[model samples]
Target chain A: MHDMMIPFGPAHPALPEPVHLKLFLEGEEVKDVDFSVGYNHKGIERTLEEMDFSKSIFMTGRICGICSSAHSTCFTQGIEKLLDVEIPQKAKIIRTIVFELERLTSHLLWLGMLGHEIGFDTLFMLCFREREYVLDSLELITGKRIVHDINIIGGVRRDIPPEMIKKVNKNLGILKDKVDYLQTLIKKDPLIKKRTVGIGNIDKDDVEKLCLVGPVARASGVPYDIRRTDKYLIYDDLNFKIVTQKDGDSFARAIVRVQEMFESIRLTRQALTLIKPGLIRNKPAMTFTEKEAISRVEAPRGELIYYIRSNTTNKPARVKIRTPTYANLMCLNKVLVGNNLADVPVSLASLDPCLCCTDRVTVVREGKEEIIKLEDLHGHH
Target chain B: MFHAIVDCVGDGLIVDKIKKYCLKKSPWIFHFCTGGCNGCDIEILAAMSPKYDFERFGCLVKGSPRHADIFLITGPVNKKIKSRLVNLYNQIPEPKVVIAMGSCALSTGIFQKAYNVCGPLDKIIPVDVYIPGCPPKPEAIIDGIVKGIEVLAKKVK
Candidate 1:
């Protein structure tokens, strides 16, 4: 039997994002899969090198639009560590609120996309419509919908007024009801289960071997959420159980994300109740010492780690970001093989691969183009 | 300029008028993210929601460039995707409008100093509309698409 190779994206109907995957099939039975992604690279890591420590926080926030707070918080935590300054309790709670809200929005968006992927437009509309509540709440609290540049080095940028808290609570109440409905649909819907169950199966050993993070890992029964392991920010005080599922398939991934939203909502409510007015940020000295600091945050997708090396000057010496999606790419490949061609798109989307964050590290210097033999590059992916 | 180009290219006035009319009504858009973060992309998706449904205005987010009338491009145009960007642009038919959807597309936004990105999208392709934000809000994105339809209507047949 002859083998046929099928290509899926750089830009395809099922994928809203950009990623290229090459699947080798032997008459509809997949033998192997290869994927390469440099399409979304913007080289933000190199740009961070030239910016001041505080200014870079905003830059980091843009590293992934969905997880902006995670990046900024991770970067600021690193800088705050280097500066040896402790932010007030209010800042920690504020950061937690935004962080969890970002997760809520992200998970909702993912659910909508998952629905859209498998030809269920109704679910897509429902999820996106419900997502507006979270966005509105975020706008009320941080004054921005998508990229809330609230996390600065010493502390957060804004505090939720009593009135704003009430408004956010009201919004969350509405959202919680809608999400509960969606969760029920997700859990009990036979169509969703039929489509996602047993698709993109990755065993526990495969997950561990690939070093996957976030929902993808938890879905595989790995039980390793950075929020619990690293215990940064206010997570040590926050009360929530780490969500995990044992199936290690596409269905398990969706289940993990959906249940985790409830945990995130609970955490947000707790933070809002505990949040008392004091101070948002402490003015740390602009001058930084020569040292390296690394910070990790559980971004909506997975474990987002930031590495920062700073000099005595205001500018950072070097910066490197290890986004969670980048780590999960390997597992994405493993899950795609042996699936029907029709199921390829749904299986791929189930991983929730954020290509935009995965491939932003290009190190070629200005005016120094490194030319590679075109034929030689064919061996890599 | 659109009329003059149509005059030169010579799609008859009656047909050209019909083309312009239909283009303004249902501006089927195809969104592409060249590089940078996905913030602007999410905003684009949000604009499609019920709160700000661009669909009622004939704005459909098409997946393929072949059926698209307007190109909603997010992120900075990095060097790796440069050729692909041009390829997609070439795929769209005539009288198409290109809308640069974020701060990154307008002028490289946050990644202005990145070594990889060649530059803003305009340097690679002709950009008609620019929505300026680290990620412009859904309202702004909707406004930009409306502007794109206007620009598309004005373009030569």
Candidate 2:
């Protein structure tokens, strides 16, 4: 029997985002899988090098629309560490609220896309509709629905206006009820359960071996939520459970995200209540001496870490981002092998891979393409 | 036999005209996010959501370029996907319209000077409509597609 090779994406509806996969198949069963990314590389790190510390926060914010706040927050945190500036308490609370709201929107978008992949159009539309409430809240707070450039070095650009606070809470209340409904639908819907249950199963061992993070790891019962582990922002002060499921399948992944959205909602509420009138930013010195710092945040996908090095000038000497999706790519290929061809979409979606976050640049040197791995990058010498 | 052949040709011309008219009335759009942020892509999806519902004008978001009448492109085209974007554009039949859906698609937006970017869709393909925003709102997207329908009508004529 001749095994045919088929290439998927860079563009395909099944995997909505960009990434190319080469699948070797024996009849309907996938035998081997190889993949390449960088279809979304925007040269963000290189761009950061030329700009001063202040402007690059907006650049990093554009890294991935789904997790824009996370990137900016991570960047700002790293820069603040370099400058040795402490942002005001109110700023930290505002940042936390925005981060969790982004998580809520990102998960809702992922859930809707998953429903679309499973051929459940109703759930897809419903999730997206409910997501509007989150978007509206974000727009009300940050002035933009998608790319909320709320973060600035040493603090945030805007405060939560007093007039909008009541409006924000009202929207969250409606959203909470809708998300609870969604959780019930995901749990009890036979169609969703039949399609997702027992699909893309991987034990905790493989998840660890691949060095996965976020809900993907949590779904496998790894319990590695970065907000708790890193204690960044005001997460340490907040009370929230790290939701995990042991089944390690697509359904388990979905359950983990659904549970996390509820947690994010709770976190957002808590952070909002904690918000008070105070200074939002600390003014830093105009010049930079050589210094470096690393910062991490629990982005919607997983752990997002930013490393920044300050040279003698205001511009950064180097910036490195280790996004969660890059780590999750290992498990995508591992799970694809031995699965029926039809199950491929949901299995891949279960990982919730964001190529825009993962693929920063594809460097071609001497006729060979090379991707810089996470560990290879270091701060300025 | 010659009279019958002439009559058949005349009927075929009328059938072709009807098809062309239908194409203007309902142009299927296929969206390709080459690579900027996912902001424009989500706005496109939001436009298709029940609240905005681009389908009211009989337009549909098609899965295949071959079946589409308009190509809704978002993001600045990354270097790696530029060739793929061209390939997908070629796959769509002519008398088609291309709408550059965001600031990135129009001028590469914030990522304009990046090394990996190869777009501002007009540089690679002939763009009929340009909706300018970091990510254009859903109402604007609907308006852009409506403009695309007008472009399609011109091409058909």
Candidate 3:
């Protein structure tokens, strides 16, 4: 029997996102954890079906604010495949640049949240202060700060002018130094080490079993990045290493993400240099036949896959998204069960669960959990 | 006759004035994200960070609704969180103000046609200020909170 069952959030102080976890504890040690997401679901897949392909691209970008570009990129890549269109080389480089910068911002945001969860306000402050540089560069390129609607169906909607490139490069230069300082601080800080070092340990085998992607898998020594495996979006041309760590703990995850930020900085700079004078969009024909295309991209969190099906019209018949958090969520029990109650927030944040992306279609009927199809959802509505 | 009446009421009135002043200076905030994307929530945090420094206006983001003077709400309210949002609003003590941040909270934004959304926050609760954006910039969020503090001050009186 459990000594206590504490409900953490639909709204909680530790993590502001809407995920509810019922923690069964015995003397401050968490014995079991049952978590439910779907508080943030807006039935996006169903909504996608109602909108045309051109409009749905922006809608997909709003699916998760942190990984907005990743969703749109994946969707666009899938749409391009369905239309049998090839985006220009310049457009591919531009997408890659925006993609990496978005990763930098998302990872920085995650790092700050980790600090806040552990009661280190200074680290949080420092991370956010540094994050503005990345946000500014993104704004310079994409004309928006948070939800960057940079991708269109065939290619990108905007071009990075030469003057903007210089300014963005300058921002990246300053950011590189600040990131170095932060990396040193994380490595040396005893408080952070005490809070995260061995907490929420997931072994490599567990990572494979759970089929986790992104930094979570990399932290467990699994080099299963979609960027390397799929090599979509000019990643084939770019030179970068997949960051991996062997510990498979919270600290290892932090290390993997921090190291990847450096790699992102490098990749973004490389992709920026590769951006030559060329057409940004291929402007494919709007017509479509019966087709289905699955496109994958390594988002800041992990592998984000978009399966889009189109009929004779421009509207996608069915759009399905598989976000990384959905897969990483499987190990929540593994992370929380043996740990102290105080570490719950840190451990959970370490997994970097983006509930906005994860909670799309979940139906509970007669005590059985099922994923209802978009057609069924629409009919019920 | 006027002097005698003034002397009697001045001390209590002075104390009340000081109390109101303090309330206006430091308006503790409680942030809740109903169901929108995390854009606004992160923007709220950014406002609190050193760059925007919302704390300069004596605003602190509190965890519990009971300790809050202004409720900062983001996202379009969804069915799952509707009752919870109302319950949370009721939990805040009297003299509370709600500032709806982001376009979604104002009118459901792009998710207006979404099946699960049941919001535009004001339908569920009274909203004093609306900061409109896909996710309003941190500066705008801070500005909205300052306005919320003003509304809270009026409510206290």
Query: Reference contacts recovered by each candidate, as fractions?
Result: 0.84, 0.73, 0.82
Per-residue lDDT tens digits for candidate 2, residues A1-381, read 338988888778886677888889999999998887767877889988988788888989988888999999999999888888888998899899899999999999999999999999899899889999999999988889999999987788888877788888899999999999999999999999988999898899998898899999999999998898889999999999999999999999999999999998899888888877889988788578899899998898899889889989999999999999988888876788888888899899989988888886434559666776532321101
Off by over 4 Å in 3: A363-381, B1-15
lDDT on C-alpha atoms for all candidate structures: 0.85, 0.86, 0.90
Q: Which 10-residue window of candidate 2 chain A scores lowest in summed lDDT?
A: A372-381
Candidate 2 clashing pairs? none
- Candidate 3: Cα lDDT at A251: 96
What value does DockQ give for candidate 3? 0.58
Runs in model 1 deviating more than 4 A are: A360-381, B1-18
Clashing pairs in 3: none
Model 1, C-alpha of A331: deviation from truth (Å): 1.1
How does the DockQ of candidate 1 come out?
0.62
Worst 10 residues of 1 chain A by lDDT: A372-381
Q: How many residue pairs clash per model?
A: 0, 0, 0
Q: Can you write out model 3's per-residue Cα lDDT over A213-294, one digit (the tens) per residue? A: 8999999999999989998989999899999999999999999999999999999999989988989998888999999999
TM-score-sorted candidate list, best first: 3, 2, 1
TM-score of chain B of each: 0.88, 0.90, 0.89
In candidate 2, what are the lDDT values of residues B1-157, reduced to their tens digit?
A: 1122334666466756765677766788888998878888888888888888888988888788878888988888887778889999999887688999888998988887787787878999999998999878898998998888888878866
